[model samples]
Target: MRELLITWGDGGGELAGRLVRELRAAVREGRLVAGERLPASRVLAAQLGVSRGVVVEAYEQLAAEGYLVGRQGSGTRVAAGVADGGARPPARVVETEPRYDLKPGTPDLGMFPRAAWAGAVRRALQGAENRDLGYRDPAGLPQLRRELAAYLGRVRAVVAEPERVMAINGVGQGLALLVQVLARRGRPRIAVEDPGSPGTLALLRAHGVRPIGVPVDEEGLRVGELAASGAQAVLVTPAHQYPTGVVLSARRRTELAAWARAGGLVVEDDYDAEFRYDREPLGAVQGLAPERTVYLGSLSKTLAPGLRLGWAVLPGRLAEDFRQAKQYADLGTGAIDQLAFAALLESGGYDRHLRTVRPRYRARRDALAEALRTHLPQARLQGVAAGLHLYADLPADTDEQAVADAAARRGVRVATVGPGRLAPGGPALALGCAGLPEQRLREAAALLGEAVREAGGTVREAGGAVRDVGGLGGAVS
Candidate 1:
């Protein structure tokens, strides 16, 4: 243990964190055998001349991260499988694997704030009380609820109060819970924005709630259509419609809110509103109709999705029922995770992270737009100023499947919007730019352009005057 700590670093304030990292690396590298007993916190601390709290904290963090297991009298041991020592094989890059991944549903993983997140976790563990460690309220940790409510109010103009907020695993779970509650409340059809997230539509159906798809145009979801569909409850991505990228217009917002004010339920998925680049993002529709809106948001967009953290702001009438539903769902999400997220939010660490990441995402978005302009000039790109994915409208007669298949053969994956949603509008592709940098985005554009032509569509040329559209001649380092 002393040797391991020595190899990690000279002990100080970061001793616990460094120890956790060091032990994790040892387990991953096969230096630590699985099921091997670890030194007790006191013994290890004495041996290393550090406080026992350091070792205890290290053990706790490792346990939380699933790297180590601790038992009362059994002591701690390295976890199985992920780090079995000597049995783990080396990693190698697969040549046939796609060179770049620009598919939607993932964020720029490279920009994750490792140090800040670790610090937040450390602080949360140190500050958490004994009661906080137990199976507590299903509404989520009060600390997290308080912080998240404040953060949402200040950042999104959301009408959130701690008592009415419920922390969820992510938007998926949030929607599931909402659907269940609504289904029990006699809402059989859950209206959703057409050209919206198909995954969400599937989620609604899987939860036994029929989905009513309403058409969305340039200004956003058609409120007229929504009202005509006869759905008392609707799930919408109003900030930026999935696959369409249009913000809800002022008229539409007023109309939707008025509908909700008249007792219609609104479930707002404010996806990617934090990453907007054009103008200030519109306030959430939930804010427009708090009494009827159930606002759903998650860190999946602004933060790493792997964190699996999100929250729902429920109306006063449904808040208690939603909390009870969450309690029955999974006995509530992990409290430690909630506390850590709260710590990050209270310290403004989350905001700082967004500030740093937003610009990078914008640059990637710009690169994709530039590539599209130069290579696939016949395709007009819309919704480029917000969200990680942009909607590329191909010629009215272009074959979407051919463009999609051709791009797939070349190593890029363009989103293929299926039937029911693409009606009336020409064939379009939701090109995701978040996962790739400038050069890869440009290359992806060039590949898609070739696919479009092969699929019986014409490509426009800029007379060869611009060598690289969007200054993407070479990949930005």
Candidate 2:
């Protein structure tokens, strides 16, 4: 055993107990793994400025609990099987003091209603029938589908009845199911937004479906281009378009409905629709043309991402095909989670939670915008009207990866839209604002602004060029 110097608040009456608590926590967390030797009592006592007896007493207690073993003259060591010896790989870059993290699609986890959710889970377990504990309907629990239908109807105006709503694992799984069904039906070319979610693009491509990229602009997905793509189906964010925050214009929505009516299918991903700030919540496009659109939603955003609960409201024509697809895809979602979610909805807890989080999210949005305005003043902020992130168009001349790397170096994490592009290349950053605290947002922005400056670019209004104060000439054109 080597001397492990443990630090505590004060080396007084409670010092030994505190030290034992920390040591146990380290063991539990896998920091002090099985077979790892502990510090000698004398050495630890000297290091912590405590009496040796205190350290001895703590070690004895730990030994008694099987956390440690004292071999005669061999010294004390962590007990085998007390914890696994293998440790998770170290972080690529440790965040000793990360000022900001602007990676997109993450919610403010701090705002999650832990108390209410726990209570709901308990109640659900209590009320669930014996049959609910067994292998469930691959389509999902009846109660969840019923509750989800009513909830979606009220919130997004989705025309869903209990029979039409099929719960899946998450949006990813729902998309996979849709892809399988559509591909089996011979619809291979699924059009998507150009700078859409890379993961979603990859998922579509995995099932032999060709993802044709149609460009998105301030008004959202370009309808004319989508028509020109000759694709049988299109995946759209609609309410708040990914990476750009553009709501599908009413004309475009009508046009899309007409196109779908003519033949094409619209796979509506109402992602982040519940978080819209500047406008009244928009109704799902599926409501306008129920027979032509498939509405997908998840608790990933509204609740916690770990829940892995999502639903698909299929058009009447495609309902059976989707269910068959679901049957072949892992049986179904967990019954307990579905029941818990249903309880949350039935008790009006979900809406109550949403009401609380919206303001906090809005404040976060405001903080990020203010930070950008103050620090990266020359940068253009797009997608600010809604969603958890904004697309900041950097000076046209600046390479986005260089900016991303520079930000990483300074403890501010941000990403770019270029790499996500099917046909890559764009001068923009995807700045996520939800996970960061407001006080640190300013500091993070300052670091990011400094990084941009270092990368031979200037900050300015979105459309304005970044004047190269670094003397390399104007970077933005």
Candidate 3:
């Protein structure tokens, strides 16, 4: 092992200051990684031929500032959150090995095109005017709006003009804006798919919008039930429905369009529609009647979630109200990010990156499916037509939560659709195949199978509960 090189300070006023700077530089350069115990004060003093008290004082200053975490037995290890000075703790402990993270709704960050992104940022900065730095449009930069309008037209068949497109932080904020607009119309009750995204459902409720649960089936949202609930607005993920990946059937799509045309409004969340592998891409329901549908799409899946960039194509009637809502929300998304994304779209970089990573994700998805088949032949799979994650049905006797707990104990993280249920005992586990490396994906699936077996149930075989074409099991869980 290489030894830490410490230089002695002078007796002058600047000596201690120089030493602190050197020490900080060493840590910043990763000469000291987290958890590596530092030398004792006496040892460091002797090595540097300095007074022991000096070393001790330096260590004390760092500890007080949260740079070093010290314990009687643990010595001084690097502490995370040093910059925040203990305002936040470290993130949840995640297993390092087996690297498979099948958690749902995240894209493979490893596949993020760093070079292209950097290029876009550089180009944007170079062309940016001094006035561009000012807090400008709250509805996003004009260039990005135009680029997105063009892109959405081709991909989602959205009838988006730049004027109708409003860029906001993300889906969460987009939903919030819609809630405010609908609230103005006295439409407080919103219908969500049964077993829909919990975070989204809660966000609506927090904003004083009541969300009623409507059942989703192979044909997608139950339109008749949606009407019966007396909800004036509804959120539907039509392209590849969340958790189940079911495409809204043609008949149902028409029925929904009719429903919207008659009176109600639709919030069509086009989440994860780009990653469909099986059939041809389905045009958004918004395309049929842009006047009745409020279309929401985001880069959280296609690019990365941290970007906080998403767009909503509102109908002409609701356009003015939605734009005003955005103005009061966050003054639009940051201008720099909007320009960067617009460059990404105009340059064709975003689609290129997607083409590159799609095969890699496809491979990981296949690995997960094969692992399920080999390890637990009886488990049924569902919703693999398109999307980052898929679902599997556990036997009725199996405790889905217990299996999730057991998997976590073995350093695996898998989720269940049952917990997302508006009712109890949904009997399914939602497993995401994205973000994890192939090896980890296989291991996680195998661990899940073991977890199911330990929970005292077996997956059914060939004639069992297969639902979608990609071996996604039953959604009735």
Best by TM-score: 3
Worst 10 residues of 1 by lDDT: 468-477
Candidate 1 Cα deviation (angstroms), residue 130: 1.7
Candidate 2 local distance difference test against the native: 0.80
Task: State the local distance difference test value for candidate 3.
Answer: 0.77
| CA lDDT scores, all candidates in order | 0.79, 0.80, 0.77
Instruction: Look at candidate 2 and tell me the lDDT of residue 214.
Output: 93
lDDT tens digits, residues 293-358, model 1? 999888887777788899999999998888888999999998888989999999999999998988
- Tens-place lDDT digits, model 3, residues 363-391: 88888888998887777877745778877
Q: After superposition, how far is residue 376 of candidate 2 from its true place, in Å?
A: 0.8
User: After superposition, which runs of candidate 3 have C-alpha atoms over 4 Å from their true positions?
Assistant: 1-99, 457-477
Clash-forming residue pairs, model 2? 102-432, 378-459, 378-460, 378-461, 379-460, 380-462
Indicate the TM-score of model 3: 0.77
Find the number of clashing residue pairs for candidate 3: 11
Clashes of each: 0, 6, 11
Scored by lDDT, the top model is 2
lDDT by residue for model 2 over 379-453, one digit each (tens)?
988764677777788887786766877887888778667645676445787777778777777788889899888
TM-score-based ranking: 3, 2, 1
